[model samples]
Target: MGMTLVRSLFLIIHQKMSTSSSAILTPVGVRGMNVLDRAKFLRNIKIPVLKVADEKLSKITPICKQYFLKLENFKPVQSVSGEKLKCIHMNPEKIGAWTDLSEIDRKSLKEHSVNEDNFIMKDIELSYENWSYGTIFKAVLPENEDIVSGFTQVGHIIHLNLKDHLLQYRPLIGQVLVNKIKSCRTVVNKSSTIDNTYRNFNMEVIAGEENFLVTVKENLCNFTFDFSKVYWNSRLGQEHERILNFLKPGDVLFDVFCGVGPFAIPAVKKKCKVYANDLNPDSFKWLNHNAKTNKLNMALFKSYNLDGKDFILTVFKEYITNYCLGKEKLEKGAKIHVTMNLPAIAVEFLKCYKGLIEDEELLEKFDCEIIVYVYCFAAGTDVLAVAKSMVIDNIGCDISDNIIDIFDVRNVSPKKEMIRVGFKLGKEVIFSAKDCVSEPPKKKLCVDN
Candidate 1:
């Protein structure tokens, strides 16, 4: 009323702005959870707009275009009066009320007969769709509480590690993710820490499809396995590629504690004879399936279900029988590489390698060099030094001189690293350098048909 009917127009807009339901709060659903009430997540804001008559829109638009609302995917031209009048949104950042306009602004707009009646409130609705994921997610959550920040993708699955405080909102978080992320077909939250023996963790499907069988492609090889039953870390793709880089055609690979052959299948494709094994029966099953799925020669890709130490000995037992005893000299250009990847306690399996074989005359018959890569978790200011000492203590041999290289793979957590301790296995280590078992364990060692 202060600036005639035009000022009254804004007062009328604020009165009815609270009732505007601008867009759909699209809900998502899964088996055990209710649909998310996205309306609760949307924040209401009313920005002023300049109402233009259909006849005058073209003439007024160009002059007032700079003041138009500039939100992503939002149409600056809209109808908000419950009447279908095409109006131009004015940025709240630019002006909040009629008094906010400069004298120059008033004179320019009035030249085209636009006044306070033209200055009406446009109800602005914002949802998670309006901003970045973190922005909207934080907006929905209570202030100062932990935000569920990120997730790992395995095939079509989104794997989340939720903290205790965020556990109650897991369903809502899962639904929001499945709705927002295009590639996500399923969402799972880790239910507990990893089972130390199998390396697989318990998980609950929070949203979308319920399948846990996933197919992942790495180093140009396709590997399929039950993600819930076996352990697979997509973050270790680079580590897999690094090990592959060391192999050549016709080399022999012993992947002790291998989980579904992320390394073994690819090594066989490179013409290396791969002896892959896992303690977990489920992992052993899929390892066989993936090797066949990738079409590796069954003769070249040998799979076994045995503990880490027994698997190590079995591989060497097969190697001696097939490559050393009958043959006059070992394959000239070939090398024997053993990879023990159970980082939680793999270095201890080095005991199986110390004095692995004791026939001195037979050892002299083997000419190929033996190398072992042991993965372990160690923490200290000097990670490499700590890892080296750990290896020395477990293998029970002075391998300081025979050590090839110690590689820092990645950080498992704060101050903890997944380190690779690689070294040449001297005949001393394998032929009783230290006082270890002089005889191999009596177990089934073979080339299974």
Candidate 2:
């Protein structure tokens, strides 16, 4: 029998029980009654089952027992002739069960006659078992499996990049994610791509609270930032830790585009002096807040809000001059490291390093080498070669193959990749005016903006 027809019959029986006063509810497979006899008895007798509201079930249990009706367990079934048989019990009533009726009962019920009004037809509410987000969404929207796979959770926020076709169902998908995911309290959809220098994408809240403040723990450090304003990629936890493992206690780190101090603050906690800066004022504000929250000494860390080029030329240059030159030369175990993480344009910022220390005498006297870790996006199969060439062109010097170390970070797209090119800045690249001078390239590489 079709499930729709069976459910319709179950509702009919439920309605009759609710309205009728004398309802003799009986199970289909009684001990003494055979399949044919049970079918005959059900067809001939007008058995009215009592339907008590779910909340009032406790009060009506005694009344169900007084009538000697089967009030223990109710299992709705189909007759041998493909007719749906309704069963009712008083202990705890459930409308339907998925079971097949015997062939004899199906035929007998078809031959027997019963009032149509006794079988009340109402809407059937299907119950669902709590399952995973993908499973539940698949059950509800089997056609849009990709939508379920596109969501990313950052802290307590569920971030989704829904396709244009799935925009109509954004609310439905977002609500389901919020309901299904225990850690998520708010859900937002990516409304626009990251096109600005701040590296922040436009987002619209589709479900739950409107708040975007979140606290994320990484590398044993707690970081709090406004998700809507600043840029934070929880996916980069491994990258953050990988870089941290390379640092020593006395290393000086200059983060050119330090969004909320993800790299800087952690370095500070490791007893490294950090000079962190960002173009976004919001990022700068939170960077200071996070530094203080982490209980880092103000003397060990300095935060700045300035353009990438200006920051390198000003704040970073000052650090090199003061701590890396003259009387305040770095100790034996100390080192200088610059982090340019704006993968899209960070390679171009390498130009600032040229003519960074203009004085030949000071450049020659500078015994410590400045290592730069420039993150950039490279296309094609030979990602390391592309990244190396880009770094060499921007720095205006031929970096030796032995010193340049390029690490493949991650694939940003099918044909594009994010790679980190690390090399030490020598006197020729920093002090020699001829080697430092170079014009911008005619064509630019494709990278995230």
Candidate 3:
């Protein structure tokens, strides 16, 4: 009770919010109580509150404001002693007795016709019972364990990747999360790493509804998809915006792994023609549905359900072929942007462009530049160096001069990181790839209806 109330009041008075709470640990989980038990997280304590008349409440609060409880949604005024009065919170450290009161405090009390006679200690419930998911989780976690409060939210679902030590309390964590977050109706844990082709992992519903399909909005576009079937990182919302911001009204977007069109649909509304593809059929289905959901220009947005390698090869060939024959067209001041966002293996897919155009001679005829933004996970102190080396090794050509920018997109683990290596797709490297021998087989083009 003592520790709980003190820490709560201290953190509140200092205005330390949940942002700084994750790094902190609980020295006081509740005495003799099982930390795993949610019911054990209650504490009750009391502090002194100065009683002021209804008429003097507003006038007196500003003067002794420093001592107030400072809690959110706290109603300081109450019905007491058969009359309405305001209760100004106080503590031993600030003020206890009349003699210990500060000169200003003494003056405020005297002017308000209040004194030690009106000072009273009231009970305060200082417990995790009222704490948020962040606060409660931090309090229950073992001291020195890194908190796992960071989660990726997709619609009403909260996705958590718990560390090994945190697994023991997964149920508690999930239940608290589902209960605390109004929009969250489901909580799941990624049971394995995303090593599968679709970039989604096997997961277990730790709490709430078992439904996996949901709808969420991002970048002014509505996305509805099965969370268990596809890959969507909520943290990449800004990354999506960053890529979209770089395009002009008539620019072209080629999303090799479009996964429900996070990058594709928005570009369509931006008036940029989008050619998006995903190997996952579910992703392809939703990509088409989301385009309709946003009421976008279907003629401006085309989709395909092909393997990433095949998608890039067909799209690149068509893009260059149109430029050469004036079949399909790109307007002036509009660039061609290719996004390969599968961070784990997207670098390998860059080989799709090797010897891609047998003739980029049309490249010199156009005033535009073709930009490929390829993402990969690199583990090293210098992520950019690792990412560059990966791209060079796979493409069989040094593209140092072609690099537009190499961004440390986000951290995937303690050491591994997701990096976006963007560069100009010029002719020098497009002619050949020594390491890449796997070519796309001759077949009918796979287009999504």
Specify the highest-TM-score model's number. Answer: 3
> What's the candidate order when arranged by decreasing lDDT?
3, 1, 2
Write down the lDDT of every candidate, Cα atoms only. Answer: 0.72, 0.63, 0.73
Put down candidate 1 lDDT per residue, 1-449, tens digits, no spaces.
01132232223222211211222222112112334675555566778888877777787777778777765457788764677567787778677887677787777778888888788776767665654334344434434554542246777787777767668777777887787766678999974457446777778899999999889888888889898888887768889999999999878898987899989999999988888888888999999999889998888877888877676677666675445577523356878888988777777677777766767777766556878899888889999999999888888878999889999998776668889999998777777754743343223221100
How would the candidate models be sorted by TM-score, starting from the highest? 3, 1, 2
**Count of clashes, each model:** 1, 10, 0
lDDT string for model 2 (167-262, tens) is: 676666677667655677899987435755567768899888998999888787888889998887765677877788788998888888899987
Error of model 1, residue 37, in angstroms: 1.7
lDDT of 3 by residue, 1-449 (tens): 11232233234222222333222222144322223465565555466778778888777777777765543335445557666766776644455556667787777678778877888878766555456555665556554555553355777887777778778777777787777767779999885466566666678898999999998778888899999988777778889999999988999999988999989999999999999998888899888999998999888988999988777667767777777677877786778999988776777777677777666466565445789999888887898999999997777677899998999987776768889999998767664433435643223222110
Best lDDT among the predictions, by candidate number: 3
- Model 2: clashing residue pairs? 12-119, 12-120, 17-49, 23-48, 79-106, 80-105, 80-106, 80-107, 81-106, 81-107
TM-score of 1: 0.73
User: Which parts of model 2 have CA positions greater than 4 angstroms off?
Assistant: 1-126, 142-145, 148-150, 434-449
TM-scores for candidates 1 onward, in order: 0.73, 0.69, 0.83
